[model samples]
Target: MAKRGAAQQLQTEVKTDEELEKFLARPGLLILEVYSEWCGPCLGVLGTLRRIKLEIGGENLHLAICRADTITALKRFYKRSEPTWLFATGGKAVSIFYGSDAPKLVAVIIRELEKTLQNASRPTYQIGDLQPIEAEVLRIKTEAIKKAERIEHEKQEKKRIDYLNRCTDVIMENLPDIGVTVFGPQVSRDMFKKLSEPAEHLKMQCKDRKYLEVFAKDFEIINYSCKNPLSDDVIDQLDGKELLVCFWKIDEASGPITHVLSTYAHELTKERVAPPDDEINVPHPIAPIISPIKVKFEVEIEDGEVWVEEISSEEEARKLAERKAAEKSKSATHLQDESRPKDQEGAEDDDEEEASEEEEAMQAVQPAFPNMALDIDLGLDDNIVSEEEMVEEEEEPPKPLTRIKRVKIPPIWVANNRRTHAALIYVFFRSQTSGFLPPDPPPEPPHVVMAFEAFKRDDVMEVVEASKEDVPQYGFFTNDTPGEAKLITNSIYKYDKLEEPSSSDRIVLKVNKVQSYTMLSLVQFEPTYCSNNVTSGRMDALKFFPEDYKTDEEIPPDAQKKQKKKKKTQDASGVDESPKLSTETAKSIDIAAGDENTEDSPKALEGEAQTPEVQAGETLITESPTVADPSAVPTEGAPAAGDGTDTQEPPKEEINADLIEAPAVDGAAAATPAAPTDPAPME
Candidate 1:
């Protein structure tokens, strides 16, 4: 077994806004490294950090690492690949830098340490709003996470299939009398006395811990209360094998609320149908409830038995279990008596002794090759040896066998009447659970070797569909849900903005949502142009499900045209204002900053107040913060959403590398904590 280490390597772990505030409240200068899980920290700067710590000592400085993706205060800094260094004295950031340049890193550390020691600090501070991470680093090693999720999904599917399969077998095994529920034409007397409450037996037995344990193993059933959100129609549709696969996804997303609890808990009027009958422990009623029940008893033939012979569902289930166990026991005993004194019996007797030798040998030699034999099977002359081989360069990922083709098709949602004039920007493959289902008895799209194509919904440009077999891909370029897409165009916007607002309307586009099954278009948005927000955002294709790839490394022609269009947006310092985005990014943007009252065009972005300086298929999130009320904020305060007061954040500023390289120490870089944080962490 591998040796286990400490639970966390960081000297201080700040997981929340409150946690970070607490860390900042402590004395001394704190060096907080803005961190990301996707990329790695710079290992080369560790030795310099160690020497700086030895010289400066502990009380004058501190160090820490934080995940921008999780910690709310650092969220906007999510996904950065380059190392971001933030120097904080007290609660405010004193300086910031990017990249792991050793000289600059050391200088910043020592400079801040000395200032803290002398109590000579500046009056003003920079609220460090960190840079957004690059897309490529966000992808590295993530395949392992996706693979793990896919494996877990498969395990659940297997459980469901095993359950449903057994249900079918049980009904078949008890041919003529699986148990009858109806009063047939031949009988005035019913074997089962009708109870006013039908299915009460199931209601009672389902909750019984013992019964639940047994039933749960087969049906994938959990928390099956009377409050389950199964409508009559949903029940009728569940006759197919895909019921479990679809609902909990009913095909993975129940409108982004994947679980039943998330989808219906808000509507539920009661915490539980069978709430405890106590005055103080009262259950509060919410606004909504699960579908009303008007269950009609249906008579179906199970092995030609339209009548249930058993007195109760529980008693019947009990009998079935007992009968199965008895038969299995009898069979085992019979087999044991018949096979007495055989070689198998003697081998079974020696199992413990043989196993002991095997256990002892396992420590020294574990035979784990896929097709290799055990110790018993090894030849007399076989030898186990360890060989040291020269390390080879890592192999590059396999190139996509398919090309992204550009074709013209009228938009899938917006401007349907318009002829084909959009370009496909991206195509992703997702499992059915992601909530986008293909046609019932879906027509085969002639399987190709792993391939992808792109499309974007725009006023004018041509696009083509990239098809795959099982998964559904979502394009988050639109500002509305599936039903609200048509409500976007002036001629096309169908819903009233004041009366019926889209759930994701105006929200910063961080995630992708698929509304259309086909097409793409791209072009310049006229004053009347209704298109996806390309500024303040960029594309990111986070592929979900196993072997479902969204590899579009080569840029299509339309992308080049748009890239040229955004060229004038460059910074005055001659630095390229536009980010070097990876081709695979889905290019997301939040156009929600627009005012709703400003438009009657019906277009989703018609009221967009800001044209955004960063114009392209992507948005530069670092450029601006959405300020709800400027009057309420302090003169130097950063802008924030919702609240009148801006949420204080670290500023986005960089300390240039000053060429202050320290002499290198030869030992392997160790975990050396400075102040309270690990300034230079090994990747």
Candidate 2:
């Protein structure tokens, strides 16, 4: 038994005749695959097999895979890259199929199963013999097939060259500028002539992949450049200009040219070849990104989190990588120095060794899962073997409506993810005109959610049906600092007129065009009260928590008591306070549990804050100015609405002062609970 790599279908690994017999004996109609050890089974077929099992129901079928070279019956397919399917029932292979033809395989299996189902008594069974062919004969057939495929490929190549040759001379106005805007420096007329200069191997991706697979091992088209690889005349033309062009051979566009990709910007520099071992490496920085839970992204909470904006170019990423690597080197040196102070005599040698170690650590070599180039995409589209590959997904049951909860976002979520804010907004709306309560906050924020991936990284301002909607926009924003990765939005569309604040700022929609938002240098204001009348049918408006807002467990015992007592007393009075308003204000502002000395806490404004909305029918509720301790001050000259009733008020705990002057969050009010006195609750 030759040693096979682990990726080979080893679950039903057939080593001996006994194992093979048992596998075939599996109760239902079984499809056993034969694969070589060196050349693994086609992985793309795994999805198809899974669909077959799921669609037809697994109880009716059994699927397995085993090494081909080990089984004498499969010796003909031992080294073949194409697949072989062995259909078995009643402890033996009944029929066989060669090639990874998904449609043919599916049709055959389905027809067999249908025949079995229709003729239960008088069954139609076709016994196809599994014979092993002579190695020489197999080689001859393979050679003939290869020669035919080569001629066909050459013909296609000629066609492609003819097309390019026509375009090279004649200035055809339309030269198929497809994917230029998205994946380009754009391939222009003059540039297309220069594009024909990417050495012959580079033009053909297969040839390029074959070369890279042997040398690079990573199966990626790494762009490298020399100061002047082109002739002087060519160099003179493109010297200072960015090469706004890329080329895709027009020949390979059936369906599988699917992964046709983009290029990395490689600056042509002076040719400087060094010894392979001493290539003078630059190591990438290996700093752990801060992404903590609950309160805020630990990156923001921790001192280690580095704020990295857009790494716009390869130059920028490389520079950042170098700086990160250096930081690690220094940190490692510091640790080593502490551990072995007595070895200070060889400190210089130790430093050299450490530098070498860093270089080795950053070496672009991954030895594990060797020969994975066979599976790597490498910008080649695979041939679609099956026609009409429709995936019918069973309709899942409608999930119960969930109330939106606070999402504790990590700092790393902002990196490479442009839709960080926009996506979180959709969590609230059931549809454009409808609103639904998001699910309650779990102990830990869910780090993943389902999404339909329609846009790529470069598709920033794509216009969609939803984008044209006149409905108000929604998204996340940070209150702690401006321009931080927003956690969620406080977007509320109130159909009520608002009172003009003396010093409130306004963003006049001078135009309805979309503009990128800038943050932190903001004058945001939040209302102290959240009205329950915003939703239609007077449904309580959905509310969620912010960064400063503490969970039930985080809330201090005394503060919780104050909240409960306050709610009880409010019920006693005729004040119609919304449950959300009462509880939301208390949970949001009761950060008395936090370290008072912590400097990061946001400072609220002095004096009482006001809600701009002054609807006649809408009852007004405010987080009235709270005293340090309610018992310290005595109430006087207050109207007794509770008929001579002496009621106990909420114990006034001094709320975090940082929350006083709430930032102007559009929909949500700055809900800091007022210190309740032993009197009728203020309305």
Candidate 3:
């Protein structure tokens, strides 16, 4: 079967059943396709079969189709139903596929051949009742169809060429001034005929404008020199006039065409009409550049100080240098005096010893530093102090600090972290005339906030004024936890006034993040304090910790005593409870807690513990819990009156909810009796 496939290529042999059988007799495949002459589908399939024949022209496979009307001829194989195909191995039909789909037939033949050819030897069949005349007629019909296809392809090729010529003609019409300066590699005269023909306008310019002509490097044009690529005299003639130029080709891998083009454009622009040794000052107009020039234009590299004004005269340049020298001299003198050695021994001492002495002096009395620095205890072992000495120290051994490395923290990092936490810090304009205020922080972990996105707070003014602002904002914060959300101002000068004499309700305006802030409010002062009257009405102005805080465990025993005395006097005086001045108290709490604990811990009684707010006419009535140690007998401050009578109300009534509430803090509920475990007992 393989030999037949190879032999068929060398001769125009018609396939007979006997030949197919002989081909299949070997260890190969037989594909018998059965069809009728009257079937239109069979004709279509024959075309595909010829295509397949071309594709697999060298394969060990036989394809044959029998007319169903001639049943006796196909009896040994398979009968045709419409068009049918049989895959045979070793003279026995392995599989039969019936279809008009040429692709399906081809697939089945290939699949069957793949399955059977590996295991069975090819089989031989007899070519019965087939005449040479009928085979010749089929071959003639196939050749006629191929001839028709060739005619159709040639027609398409002619149309495509006509369309391309039309496009090229249009391109050539607009390119009259284009100068074809061919360099390197000559095309034959026949190929040169294909070059863009010079139009009438270009032909006229040949006499005066010197239109380009191509010539071999060894041969010059009718009058031009080849050795000198660009003649100064030629360039002078082209000045102040537009000229189209082209390099026939360029090899960037070598040569200096780039450098040459740069020098050409520069010298042409300056109208440098003289050789280096000669003097000529010919002024020329800057001419319009015509297409197409082949030169890479890139920004020139310049020295850092290139932008400094160039002194026009030598005298002026020297004066500027002298001024700079004087400035440097003053700086050098100051630096030298400050850094100079006081003594030989002082200079000999290591920086460590000097640093230690400076540190001791700093401890004794701190010097004013411009920048805030964190004091870190770096316990570098000198080996002089034994491990025993570390153990002898009462406190836990300090963690080793290698060096005080200052790290720059970007504001964006903080803003992004806050955004992820669903909290934002941005300026919000209260009214058109007023400045913006810092937004209330988010009530979640700072690290959870997403990136900052800007938005206008006033855009949702109706929502804001309706007392639904916080809920929606919180929802936005929670929902947009992974993205930065910003609110910017809607208009200029429509925000809250920062230094205004009159106190008014802040207007709805944009509360945008810093990065998105384009309109800046020039606040007279930063960190403007909120008045008591405004805070009571606008609760949104108040900032609170994200998580609930547990009250402090205990005030120092002495501090507690001080609070009681103050409270007694307030109650005796019968004064109305004013807003708490808890700045000092908050500071003290922060100090005792080592900055980690952010609880709303009341200050130890100076007998008059203040609330956190500095607002006027606001009151905080601290109540003693039942669980509080009686021996501690802690006093809760009372509201004082003019008559010096204690008029303070008892703590708010406790409800059942208090008993079932989750612990306020993570670690401590039972341990701290000073922190009220329950709400104040009912009056």
Error of 3 at 644 (Å): 99
Once fitted onto the true fold, the runs of candidate 1 whose alpha carbons sit more than 4 angstroms away are 1-10, 126-683
Better of 2 and 3 by lDDT: 2
Candidate 2: stretches off by over 4 Å? 1-11, 118-128, 131-683
Candidate 1 similarity to native, TM-score: 0.23
TM-score: which candidate is best? 1
* Per-residue lDDT over 99-164 for candidate 1, one digit per residue giving the tens place of the 0 to 100 score: 888887887787777888888947536444422332344464356556755766787578655653
What lDDT, from 0 to 1, does candidate 1 have?
A: 0.38
In order, the Cα lDDT scores of the candidates are 0.38, 0.38, 0.36
Cα lDDT of model 3 by residue, 546-616, tens digit? 12322222345666657645754564454536444344554564465353332322332333423332122
**Ordered list by lDDT, greatest first:** 2, 1, 3
TM-score of each: 0.23, 0.19, 0.15
Model 2 poorest 10 in a row by lDDT: 206-215
lDDT, residue 287, candidate 1: 29
